[model samples]
Target: MKKIVSLLLTATMVLGLAACGNTDEETPETPETPGEEETLTGTGEGYGGEVTVTVTMDGDTITNVVAEGPDETDGVGTPALEQLPEKFVEANSADVDVIAGATVTSRGLIYAMKNALDPDANPWPMVEEEEDPSNVEASDVALGFGISSLGRKGPGADDTETQVWSINEVLASALFDGEGKIIYLNVDQVEVATPNYDGEGMPHLSGWPGQGGYNIDEDHDEKVDGVTEDTEENFIAEVELWKTKRERGDDYKMGISTWSEQMDAYEETFVGMTVEEIEEWFEKYTSDRNGRPLKEGSEDAEDKAKYDALSAEDKEMLADVTTSATMSLNDSHGNIIEAIRKAYENRMGLEITEAEAAGFGVSFMPRIGPGKDDQDVQVYSLNQVFANTLFDEEGRVVAIHVDQLEVASPNYDGAGMPHFSGFPGQGGYNYDEDHDEKVDGKTEDTEENFFSEIESWMTKRERGDDYKMGISTWAEQMDGYEEVFIGKTVEEIEEWFDKYTSDRNGRALKDGSEDAEDKAKYDALSDEEKAMLADVTASATMSLNDAHGDIIKAIRASFENREVINLSVN
Candidate 1:
């Protein structure tokens, strides 16, 4: 009986040992096999609002990460969100460096990633609250104004050998928050040269592009009349001699210099400065020939030393360049500053002194006509006009006006008659004879008579004058086209541009249907008018397209910068 009991105990012990080993093997096998990728999403407070991050892991290894913050500012917090995903994936961990300017957003992104990796983990420390000075309120407003000019010096009586032209565009944007503090200020300038010439031509001027008879070598050494290179001391001596000659009223020309290279220096000084401060600087510096802050014994030791190192002749040359630059600034920035001030006043409903309502201006001079060919050089001039309405908080246009100014040289034919080229001047239409009228009282041409003739012709044509122009009068077509843009947003206007401006297959907005008045007017036009209609419509369409492009560009700039902008309906 004792032997049988002992055998039963041994069997039980063996069975228990087998069961333990099996359980241990199965437990580890279940977790060892690779499982499906796990994805988790978490959100945390960011600079603007909740920032979300999604993390995907394959077993214990991080596979992918994505973060998004829609409410963040474009150039600030947005950059942090864009950069954090790569860091999370590479480290296979949530710890990462915070972006410099976007600390809150960066920390939020990291916290969200951590949460995604371990949902049950303790939450990250809350971001410390800090006052934001740039926070915008509903009542906050900003005003921006852009102006451009194209100036041309026509062949004058004394200096008729060459023509000179310059184009400059300036944009002044000022942001005033709800607290009436100018939080942001940006001023940009773009200067474009004319097509062919490079500064040197008639009147023998002494400035950039015109060498003033002085030849400068690559090392900036100056020589005159094939003479040997002048030493720095000798150059200074010659300048001193010239000063004596000038004191005695003898005319002498100095080497030319340009202020274009110094524009950035001038721009840097204007930034972060108030309008009054900028005006004061302008008044002070522009009055003298320096065109900038005085460099002699400047607060910046480097600048003072550099100025001291320059030769006397070089110093004088720099002064001349600065003087020219300051003069240009007076001519250009004065208008821009005044425009911006008026724009601000208009936004606040203050009394404005300008005749027209506040609006930005853009001017471009595009060379039209034929390319270089020996014969038949085509002459063309294009003046583009863009008008945008400025709206109040209620979406009501507070200011609406159109401005037309003649800045560049007018397009003239060989006979000195003003020629309207492009789509408006199809068939070489003569403006003078085409509008002349022989009245009972007077025979000479007059503005009233000219317009009267055009109106009479249009009226007669509309009344079934058998002049089949295949189009309505220019006045009717333009009025109809302009009506299409009323009350439309900038984006909406661009969307509808092609539909209204197309002249293909009589698709122009003014090209009438079977029973439309425009169709009847077009069908009743004379053969000569009919022949001119296609070309005229084509030209007008081109003009409308170009103007629309410019207007859209201006409006987009305003919107992108988060400013209140509108287009003029009238």
Candidate 2:
């Protein structure tokens, strides 16, 4: 019976292929011309352009299938196009799952293949039904954070300099109701940079030693002779501007009426709407259904007519908020949907274990450097620490573990002279492993010990080069600091950080000061260790403050909004 079914399917495919000629209209099958392989071609509309598929068949079995969609997004759609042809040949049918996230492109390729193999037949697969959020009954808030860093290893030359590193961090949170409806959404993004270093790892002013050199004036409009309080003030103002843009609405100057209209349209389209419904609405705006560009004021009359006919809700979904504020409503909607899904799971009394409730914290050394060349080479030793805290259902931390990584370019020795060889050649230490278990009789390696290791490493790399200053690793300092954070609520952590990390003067809380206990461990280090500690303590304090501070802020913001919603409901 299986064999009979297979024969019948093969016969059906042959007849279908014969009907699918070069054009849509049926053409008589040509007798085999000398040295010509049987090939059929078809095209289907894709996300950005048409996707074409060519199929070559030997009798009833498909020998080859080639699909191409050049206009599609490279990482998202190209992968689907590259892999789907093989899938079709293996299955001998176009019935397959669309590549996750690249649905439109995958559908286009599949439709093209179906047209090539069987234009007259209904070879398209049935659309998957979206989960109905209306029936979902439980809701909870979930926060998601992502951090990415990019670095380049380079040696500076007389004519060129390298941008050593940069980091970008994003934090997003959403609140979902019992029905899996997103009630609130927020996102914050921050970026920081490291200084450019020379061949021997010595820090240099980028574009220095010339008129109109590297330093910027108060306005940051052009280079200046020197930096002053104004430079710091200006830099702070720029950071504030970036933060505002991320936290609030975009800074673009749209007409007040237009802005109000867009806001009203968004509220009408999305408020109290389920994720599925919101997605369907966005699809309409994104789709080129009438074979016309969906942008406002399209040149094509039909396209312009279609745009004009769209409801205000559709227009708002398609609206572009200036070139700089280019994030699409579709992207924001997706995030809200994910948050809703997570909230729905939590409301359903899903057993979320300690591992599932665990939160991760990350801290980078020198969180905000004075814009590259503001500090000396020795101060450039950078470290990143990632810590995860597993929490019980009661929201108490059950377990905590930390891993740290550090990198340093070449730097000046104790004499304030550049090292002969920089970075990869001088080689930095991995404090996580290469340090002594016990230093100066303190037992477990601490920040002072880590700094001692760094000094020793730096000293040995260049003979006669000594770093006699007091040294303190951010990790060692954070060891005691971490204790203050453990078992505390995120809000408590934020309060503690704001009060204890820095003094009234904005310096690291010193040994014998109000937060002396945290500093006492460092004070016990040798005279040289104390001196080495001086340069980094302030920067490390600021860095630690920013890293943990941001996480706490994100959590606090999420819960605060959650509370507001609950109050309104009550």
How close is each model in CA RMSD to the real structure? Answer: 22.4, 22.0
Question: Which candidate comes out best when scored by TM-score?
Answer: 1
| Candidate 2 colliding pairs, count | 10
lDDT (0 to 1) per candidate = 0.41, 0.42
lDDT of 1 by residue, 416-491 (tens): 2222211110112222233232111212233333223222211111223232233553334443443444455446
Residue 7 alpha-carbon offset, candidate 1, angstroms: 76
What are the TM-scores, per candidate, against the unseen true structure?
0.33, 0.31
TM-score of 2: 0.31
After superposing candidate 1 on the true structure, give the runs of residues whose Cα lies further than 4 Å from its correct spot. 1-133, 136-165, 173-186, 195-278, 284-287, 294-379, 384-408, 411-491, 500-543, 546-550, 553-570
lDDT of 2: 0.42
Q: What residue pairs clash in candidate 2, if any at all? A: 447-476, 469-531, 469-532, 470-529, 470-530, 470-531, 470-532, 470-533, 471-532, 471-533
